[model samples]
Target: MSTTPDRRILIAEAALDLIAREGLRALTHRAVDRDLDLPAGSSSYYFRSRGALLDAAVRRLAQNSRDAFTRSGLEAPERTDDVDASARAVATTLDEMLLRRRRDLLVRYALAVDPTIDPELHALLATGLFSRDAATTLMAAHRSTQPATAAADFVGLVEGLVADRLIGARSRDGIRAGTADSVEQLARSIAVFLRGLPTESTGTRPI
Candidate 1:
């Protein structure tokens, strides 16, 4: 009588761990099988092809990233309907979402780091979800003043910050008590800039 492992759980979790710890480039059906201490062909049983496994993994990564954004973004606004307040919220949300998602964001970053992925996948990587959200927040707060052109600018700000942090231009505070302080400061600066602009149409609630 031999004990067999629950193959599905073993593979799915191993795929995620591989992506999280190493990167998408390092993931392969055979490698995942090895990582899980299972015999070869187990991964192929669950996911028929490499494309299938990557498809599943990318979908999981998208949902996880979106959820992280919503968790921090959807909180009750500390200053509702005010330009400064909304900007603060966006900035705070950006840092909180990025920092809170240590492994997921890092994995996403790592995936894009390699230039060998499918071109379509790389295109998806370039899309900026946070920028759109930030613009919506800022324009909703002060549409009457500067005009609602925040879509590009706001996204640029968050993207720049994330890039800076990842590349060392931004200060390192994550995993420390000072992380909150740095994020809070970023929130204030963004709020100040956004408040000065004219608002756009009221933004929609997250779908």
Candidate 2:
């Protein structure tokens, strides 16, 4: 191939789509080339190795997630006092991801469970938009007494909610209910969780 950032990104994206549609076992340089309709060996020329291809895919996934967060305005400075708005913003972002970018999420889940994946790649997959650092920033902005712990819990809750809609028992129900219902329910759940956290103003123990 072409020596361009766009070309590399295109290849990586094709790899991710292949993984999402056919599972990790179907990911290969030849498969990616076939998916993109590129000549044989094109993917290999750029990626060089399976490990390098996986790394590129992981990086692409992270970039896509960050772009989604930025587009949703969630990456903006925290509002501090607007818990409801923040909750809704997060819910909206999640809803968009589920509806418009489900393939990315599916690929993420596939990589997350593969034992052969590199530790660094696994960590990159885990560090999503609602990562511990981002959650901690939100918690701190809200004046939570224990920002670190609260952030951990918040991230866990968000992950659980996403998983529920993706693979858990509620997956079918969430799908049938559609985007509007999912956003409303997710916003409500996030708002409740945020409000329940013990903040400096509340002077209550961490929950």
Candidate 3:
């Protein structure tokens, strides 16, 4: 019942872990309290309602993602100019998510498809691990004719790649694919995608 920041974060993280391990239906205030081994009504005291708890979990997910990105050096401006470096940076980040932070990604995907989730929260999870704005900047640095469109395509491709590794038929192989293999494979794909983009000199075509 105490209003400590750490307790709120603990509740939210417990909720995310519950969703990842047991699915969204298992995520109740009492369930979160049980997961955290907190006193009865502890989670509810902080979150007040199911929706609030879900919001806190989503926010925690986003915060964790942003922290990971920052740690991956994706925010470095110098890397954008070099497509291969950018690709590797992104690939490394993806590898981290797919392996170390798999639970967070699973929780994100689970929440994404649930209609009961808030529209704003839905928007928050829509971007997946990387934002379109970051992709747009990368595309612009690569001299894409239409950076926004290129960014959309890039984000979509990355999303599919991650999803395939996480839940698609490739899931088994992806799990066996270690960090070196995963990062190399993803970096290659990203490099090829960046290279295939229509550049400014190629000129834009009618949409």
Candidate 4:
């Protein structure tokens, strides 16, 4: 507790834990307070309304997601390369990330079905952070591609692929199959796209 300087992140993490263990319906102020070992007014102090709290929760989840992205080596130059080398590095990385994100997907799926989940959550789910826009922008920068539409398609492809794997793993069936060729397919798709581009590639993988 002494080491945690950011209470917002702490509160956000607590909320995530609650969602992970219970469900999105469990993300009330009372639940956050209980999870954080705080007094009754603690949650209200930080978030005066339910909307505020839920917004904070979404923001926190977003921050955590960005942190996880960088830490999972997605931002590393070696991993961000445009060729098969980077592809391999990232495939290995996403394999691990896919496993972790499976838990988040399960929690999110529970929220999606629950009528009590916040509207903000529904909004976020509708336009996810890994959306086609974000993915396109990022993939473009990563691959040095200029066509926004094409870049976004690759981004969408990656997002859809990752979501597919995560959803399957999160299913109650508990089967976590699909890999290797999946990565190869994605890499091949991105590579073919990049190869067709007018820009002289930096010898990187397409997506």
TM-score of each: 0.71, 0.91, 0.90, 0.64
Top model number, TM-score: 2
Ranking by TM-score: 2, 3, 1, 4
Over 97-149, each residue of candidate 2 has an lDDT whose tens digit, in order, gives 77888898889999999999999999999886466877787888778888899
lDDT of 2 at 28: 95
Model 3: pairs clashing at backbone N, Cα or C within 3 Å: none
For model 3, residues 1-207, the per-residue Cα lDDT tens digits are 655998888888899999999999998998888878888998898899998999999999999988887787766454234677778878888887887888998999998999888899998898647788888877877778888999899989999888988899778773443468888977888888876876686564212
Per-model tally of clashing residue pairs: 6, 0, 0, 4
- Give lDDT per model, in order: 0.61, 0.83, 0.83, 0.60
Candidate 1 vs candidate 3, lDDT winner: 3
Q: After superposition, how far is residue 81 of candidate 3 from its true place, in Å?
A: 5.9
Candidate 1 whole-model C-alpha lDDT, 0 to 1: 0.61
**Model 4, 1-207: lDDT tens per residue?**
454447766777777677778876677888899878899878777788867776776666666566666675555352143556545554555555565665655555565566766777776754444445544444555555464766566666556656666664433444353467545644565455545554426544333
> Which ten contiguous residues of candidate 2 have the minimum total lDDT?
172-181
Which 10 consecutive residues of model 4 have the lowest summed lDDT?
A: 168-177
Error of 4 at 191 (Å): 5.7
Tell me the tens digit of each residue's lDDT in model 1 across 1-207.
Answer: 432344554566677679888777788999898998878887898789887777556656666657666676543333245554565556666666566655656666776777766666655555624535545544554453432456566667777776666555454645321366656667776665665554334343221
Instruction: In model 1, state the lDDT of residue 167.
Output: 53
